[model samples]
Target: MTKAAGPSRRSERSRVAILRAALELCREQGFGGVTIEKIAARAGVGKPTIYRWWSSKHAVILDAFMEHIATELSFPETGDHLEDLRGWLHSVARVLAESSMGPLIAGVVGAAQYDPALAAEFHQRVYLPTRQTTIARIRRIQDEGRLPDLSPDTLADLITGPIWFRLLVAGDPPGPDYVDTVLAAVASQRFPASAGGEALQ
Candidate 1:
């Protein structure tokens, strides 16, 4: 007789299935239409199975979204901080402009307005970690004397603010050249001396 899968293996498979189902449902029906019942049905798992792992549909969807973007959205270390920043920002623009993730993110942001729990979870789980990573990377670059002497937080905002504005408020897609444009604008600004005692021109 063939041996059955172990409990841990089966549980992991179910978890992957649920996350996949959540993403598919979000793509097909948007976040508003995705429910625990629908996700469980799509994943071929019982409601209790899903509830055992995630608290709500929001938690499931957020996990799916984060898993999907985790690889592509990371900062690349190419030994050139400016180039790395460019690549990272370009990835962000592409993901926001071209993927289902954009709508999902917008939907989550909208829902978070009314759901304090979700907003707090999002801040704690998603926003804070990413922001901390970006700030740390920028601080490292500054320490290398490659970037201007400015608050890393301010620099991070200058880099990401416009892209988010276009996606969330302006309803405009950040196009292929957007990253370069933003970088040029940033590089053009005159700033105080760097750690190497050279001013940004």
Candidate 2:
């Protein structure tokens, strides 16, 4: 790297180091416990360096989570829409099963209620992808003329609601039977058509 490039590269390295440390700390300590000073110490950088890059510990950890869970967050593809839904939902459940992620996401959402900035980033970065994926799958069905037309938003919600409900309220692990039902609902509209109800068979 040239002299000009040297500083930029160093900055990038420092930013990544801080993000990595912050993620590990937050995962190990829970959302309520991690701090900037601790992250700085863990990353071997000064507190000022961390403060210069990220507005808060939340931002740093958010970026780290985006990096670590990018694959898991993505809906899996198997050339079958129902299978895609099953794999995607199971991927979500598996992430929640992690000791760290469930609490981190729940805590972030709760905090975002008080911090508008955090709330905005969380929705933009994390919430939107899963929702859009659900919609895309349904839209593909519509394109294929296999299902009645429906709003993408409605379809996304219909497919994902059960999983979120089970996650937040029942605190339950959804079994294959439940996944089958969800997949079936997508393949076959079970409710009124407004709910994007369609039967695959």
Candidate 3:
């Protein structure tokens, strides 16, 4: 059992090293350009070790990149759900504004065309949390009678879609002005026109 533990510990160390190396390489070279040989050399591990763990270089980089983001943005649980949703979007926009991050997401999207499983994973891991939280915010708004009682998912889309459409299709940065504009439009349009300043029936 002691002997078996030695290789097991080595495996954990090797795994971390590979993940770190893959992130650096993908940041510099883009995920499409990253290679297992490069990752292995950078991590100071054998190429077989990388191959042993990940089926493809993309898989290695995907795990590495996702881990990097997860560490940065924990799912913040402010009791004020609206504030949480807005803050989450703002923070997401800011994080991706970093030099390598934009490219990393782009690489994932570009690769998604050829990789069906990866596309699904991207939606699961990337889209759902961010999006679902906004849905929850919309739900709270409805509960307070601030919205038209639509489903949270649909309300979130109504509120957030324009922002995403402009950024994703127009290839523009998500400006602060645009975030506020999206929120304003959603708030006014969805509400029935009287709840203190402006809310529901």
Which candidate ranks first by TM-score, i.e. highest? 1
Those runs of model 1 whose alpha carbons end farther than 4 Å from true positions after fitting are: 191-201
Candidate 1 at residue 176, lDDT? 54
lDDT scores of the candidates, listed in order = 0.83, 0.73, 0.72
Residue 170 Cα positional deviation in candidate 3, in Å, after optimal superposition: 2.9
For model 3, how does the per-residue alpha-carbon lDDT over 46-132 read when each residue is reduced to its tens digit? 988888878877678778877888756554677866666667667667665666776677667777888787777777767776676
lDDT per residue (tens digit) for residues 1-201 in model 1 = 989999999999999999999999988897778899999999999999999999888889889989999998998998887778888889888888866878778778778888887788788888888888887777777788766677777777787889888888887769759878987786667666452332222
lDDT for 140 in candidate 2 is 79
lDDT of 2 at 180: 65
TM-score of 2: 0.77
Clashes of 1: 0
In model 2, what are the clashing residue pairs, if there are any? 187-200, 188-198, 188-199, 189-197, 189-198, 189-199
Candidate 3 Cα misplacement greater than 4 A, ranges: 1-9, 191-201
Per-candidate total of colliding backbone pairs: 0, 6, 0
